[model samples]
Target: MSDDQSPEPQIFETLQPADLASRVADQVLRAIGDGRLRPGEKVADARLARELGTSRAPVREGLRLLESQGLIVSHPRRGFFVHAYDADELKEVYDLRECLELHAAEAAVARMTKADCARLEAQVQKLYDLADEGQTQEQVVQDFAFHRMLCELGGNSRILRLFDQIAAELRAGIALVGQLYDDPEEIARSHDPLIKALRARDPARLRAELHEHLQDAQIHVVQLFRTGAFDLTNLDKLSDDQRNRLLR
Candidate 1:
């Protein structure tokens, strides 16, 4: 461990332009996912380039990619900013999610096999474990993964692609209010009914369960908006109990 002792060589590999852009996009997305970059925050290309150890070109390319994904929006002269979360907009997004998921649920129930059910069950367990571990971001990801797997089980490429289109917004919505749930374990267990319906191969029951689940989420998000709990400035002023109850 002498000062002059040779250090382990770092592994370095060159990334193609597209790969670099994708990598930058992923880092920015991860920042958003973890709440480091909140809704409506400006994403300056030069600043992000400095932080990411690249140039403005790749950062601009990444911002363009994120813009296409509905995670960020560009203005005429204001550059790019994270997409703001609006209750009304979220309601519309949830409406679309419901339509897509209900259709997928029916189709999936008809075709789900033992192996598919097992994979879903494992995802549910991961959700529970992540909740207990207080890994809120990962929990949101696992929750969506469970539903995305359901859509995949339907064996419809187009429907899966459609889901992917809204995936970022969906994740953002969850990350925004994920800590507000009264009981994380209860939230994790909510998927049980859907899984049970899938196991029984009952499309009608599965559709009903899925609809109820999404409706509950919609209600919660709307309630949070109405209560003004997403105001980051006010959040710090709230009491511990209030904060936990509002954002958990």
Candidate 2:
């Protein structure tokens, strides 16, 4: 290949015409989740279209989809940028996540099978392996996958959909902030209680364990936000009601 030639984009020949925009959105969302794209980074539709081997129309549609999910922002006149991080937003998202995931835990506990438990256990093991290897990005993805597996086990399509809506943003937030735990092994082991609770099919225990898990993450991210480690320019853009929530 020539020095200036870009590598070929991943082909999407098998996808139906109707799903083109969604495929584009997923690719871009993965890029954000994996930290290939950074917060507040400009996303050029034309550039993305060329890279994805698609027309600009679908790329524009994809950007709009990401914007609605709180992963991208559209600035008037300038164009789309990755959404900047905010502590208040992170807290709110995690609060809602806790509610949804606790409910999911209850549902999953009631219906969870041996296979489901095995899948979750394997996922947790992969997280430990990734952390041991010092693969931060892969660790982030595995962490999200473990929770996503819980949501899937709950068997509520809508609940899983709702969880997925924030998946990209959650991954991006963790990626942008760097490491959340001092010891990667400690981070991997944190999920053990939840797994044990799931195996025993104890809703109460699962709920308690899940709550602590999310709360610890919330506390960590809030500390990072307060320390001025993340971008907060967008916080000023929020209205009084929004700001009040942040203060609370």
Candidate 3:
């Protein structure tokens, strides 16, 4: 191929839809999730295509998929940037998450099983493990997974679907926030009450525990947003220092 010539555009080879999305998101989206790509930073599709040794076609498609997930936002003329939710918007997101999650908890009590209880216990253990390891982002992701597991146990398809729909945004928020709590173990230990309530098969207790848990999170998010702890003013590449700032 001549230097002046454009390379042929290549299409993905017979990958399943989920597989295709995974391949597409493997690099750029992970960068966003892991904080390599900061919120409000621009995503250049052509650069991604070149780096991935593919065509721009699938890169754009992948970005569209993320846009649908609320991980990336698109502007008519400005293209795509990592989605940045204001404090008010994040509070609203948490409210919706809490609403559906409480319902999921209520439904899960009647359906709780030994296996389900065991799984929840394992997840809680994982949270503590991750916290001890000081993997802040990983632990936050696990926290979301624990809640998501509860929804799955609830066995309500629509409710689970809705929770998954908003989960990506919530995960991003929690992972990047600097001060969810002063101590990471505090975050892990907080889930114990809910698990206890679940094991007892006590609807009233489970609902109260779950509600208080989510409400405390909402309060912190609102306070963090007010304090401007996330440094939204700078939309540049995530540096080690900046990432460390949010890691605790």
Candidate 4:
């Protein structure tokens, strides 16, 4: 084709704000995981809209969703920025997790069905196979599923809501630690004891194992930060629309 007769690029339209926001949220969260969006960076609405090839409305909604998940923060007049977990925030998150998980364990013991436990066992088997196959990310996902199953078995809506909230925060940290460590065996070792305890239906041991697992994750997160594998400051670049979502 001649220079003056360039081929027309594909033009797709009909983007829905709610759906677009969800898509934006997923993309931004993954970007955060991969260190593209550093923690504490301002998220500009206009810039993000421009980058995503969409309008600011959906970006605002998406930012709101992420902010609610504790992934970002909004400031008056300034804009939205990535939210970082300080020492106290970190401790509180894990401590709450420990309490919720302990309660979940007790509930699981009292209410878990043969089928629920069987499904969990199947998850454990999948993790073992993934570990053996050396699929690190798949193993991490399965590991999360295993604990999520225990939480679901508890049969409590309040606990389920809290678990979902904490799980989102935990996933970011888990992904960071896994990338830094690059050791699936270590992850398996940590998970195996928890699985065994759950299998035995021993609430006491289950609680202890779950607590240990969170502690191990916390330590790994710190280690990753110290080694410069993860940085919180990268979020300073988020646009206002992104931050507003957090504050709202």
Q: Which residue pairs clash within candidate 3?
A: none
User: Which 10-residue window of candidate 2 scores lowest in summed lDDT?
Assistant: 239-248
Clashes of each: 1, 0, 0, 22
Q: Over 4 Å off in model 2, which ranges? A: 1-19, 50-55, 122-140, 176-178, 230-248
For residues 1-248, what per-residue lDDT tens digits would candidate 3 score against the true structure?
89999986542233333445457764565566446676789888776666666677777888888887777888988888988777888888899989999998889889988998999999999989978898665666677778888988889999988776665456435654335767888888999999899889999999999999988888877776667766543323334443333221
Candidate ranking (TM-score, best to worst) = 2, 1, 3, 4
Residue lDDT tens for model 4, 39-98 = 677788777777777898888888899998888898889988888766556656767877
Q: Residue 108's C-alpha lDDT in candidate 2?
A: 94
Instruction: Give the CA lDDT, 0 to 100, for residue 52 in model 2.
Output: 72
lDDT score, candidate 2, position 131: 81
Please list the C-alpha lDDT of all candidates, in the order they appear: 0.74, 0.74, 0.74, 0.68
Candidate order by decreasing lDDT = 2, 1, 3, 4
Clashes of 4: 22
* Highest TM-score scorer: 2
- Candidate 3 local Cα displacement, residue 72, angstroms: 2.4
Model 1 alpha-carbon drift over 4 Å, by segment = 1-24, 49-58, 125-141, 176-181, 231-248
